[model samples]
Target: MNPLDPAGIFISFEGGDGVGKSTQSRLLGEWLREVTGRVVVWTREPGGTDLGRVLRQEVLHGDDMDPRTEALLYAADRAHHVATVVRPALERGDVVITDRYLDSSVAYQAGGRSLAADEVERLSLWAVEDLLPHLTILLDLDPTVGAARLTDAPDRLERAGDEFHLRTRQAFLDRSAQDPARWLVLDASGTQEDIHDAIRAAVVTRLGDALGVADGASLGEREVG
Candidate 1:
């Protein structure tokens, strides 16, 4: 049975570093609030809750560890995040827009680190009690281009090298292809406005009935930064 709350909509934005996921997630959350008049919970993985915050710092800055250890720490953070923040928000009938979800674990831990993809996926699903996003918008971009867009110092994962990022990107594409209905693969090279428009359209299409809006109804134009 589906674990997600029937009254809530869950959307996740996923992409490599500097691919504009944070910007897009914020814009989408704002648009959803305006259109649906429902509470929108905008959050991110590995730092969405109190426990997650500490785990995020350690995982991103601490000494290098075994790939399995890193994956387990991420799963632990995800378990706490979903149980405390995401699941409760969904139970309250809110729209939850997360910056990353289980797919990120599969991509980064499994693909980037060369671990078993199925194992990584299984660990994440178990951590979240089988919860899954209603929609996953993947901003696909060339790793080189994405790296160039990052203005900050490299984090542990960001400095994992081009080959790792390439594998991660391919993993995302492969997963999207395997589940096309729940995934919207968008090119990250597009203008911000254009990308936001496409994302908005996808969200509207999926949740229009729940939001009491007709298909293709315009949600009004607004600048998204």
Candidate 2:
């Protein structure tokens, strides 16, 4: 793929359970297409491709698996996702937006499960091979609030409880704080319109040139220094 196109930005949406990631991702994807006229490919982690979706079901629904084993499953799904979906889309100069990525694993499994963060990061680096998203938007919300939005009984991970979600939330915050330039925290408590507005603003401010024209200032050209 040529490196000159400015349409190769990958933006990821992240947060704890029921933090409105799905809703915001849809809204943002639609808005980007309407405003920027760039083809947008939207997908979710652990389930972007066929193999990834199967692995996602295993990891999310199957019986108890060790943290390391579960983490490996997630990494596998991510690898396939990046290879089949994300990489191809970006090579075609499409804006690929994913619902979650390595950060979710680091927060949920490593941070919440008490596994080593360094280990998770190391494994993720191997899985993604340095294809980090140009921007990660983390929707910050209270664990209780986010969990309550789920109508059905909790899944294995969701049943991990409020404390687990709290830890995951903190993990996300810590990561965003650590990498201020790459991550943006949007409050997920208010109206959907408000949340969408904030997200749009962040995208425009962070990826101004990439939104419309093909300039060197686009995300494809500028590496996160």
Candidate 1, 1-225: lDDT as tens digits: 568888888999999998999999999888878867789999999899988989999899878989999999999999999999899999999999999999999999998996999999999999999999999999999999999999988989999999999999999999999999889999999999999989988877876776555566556633232
Per-candidate TM vs. native?
A: 0.96, 0.91
lDDT of 1 at 194: 94
lDDT against the true structure, each candidate = 0.90, 0.85
TM-score of 2: 0.91
Clashes in model 2: which pairs?
Answer: none
Worst 10 residues of 1 by lDDT: 216-225
**Most accurate candidate by TM-score:** 1
Give the C-alpha miss distance for residue 2 in model 2, angstroms. Answer: 16
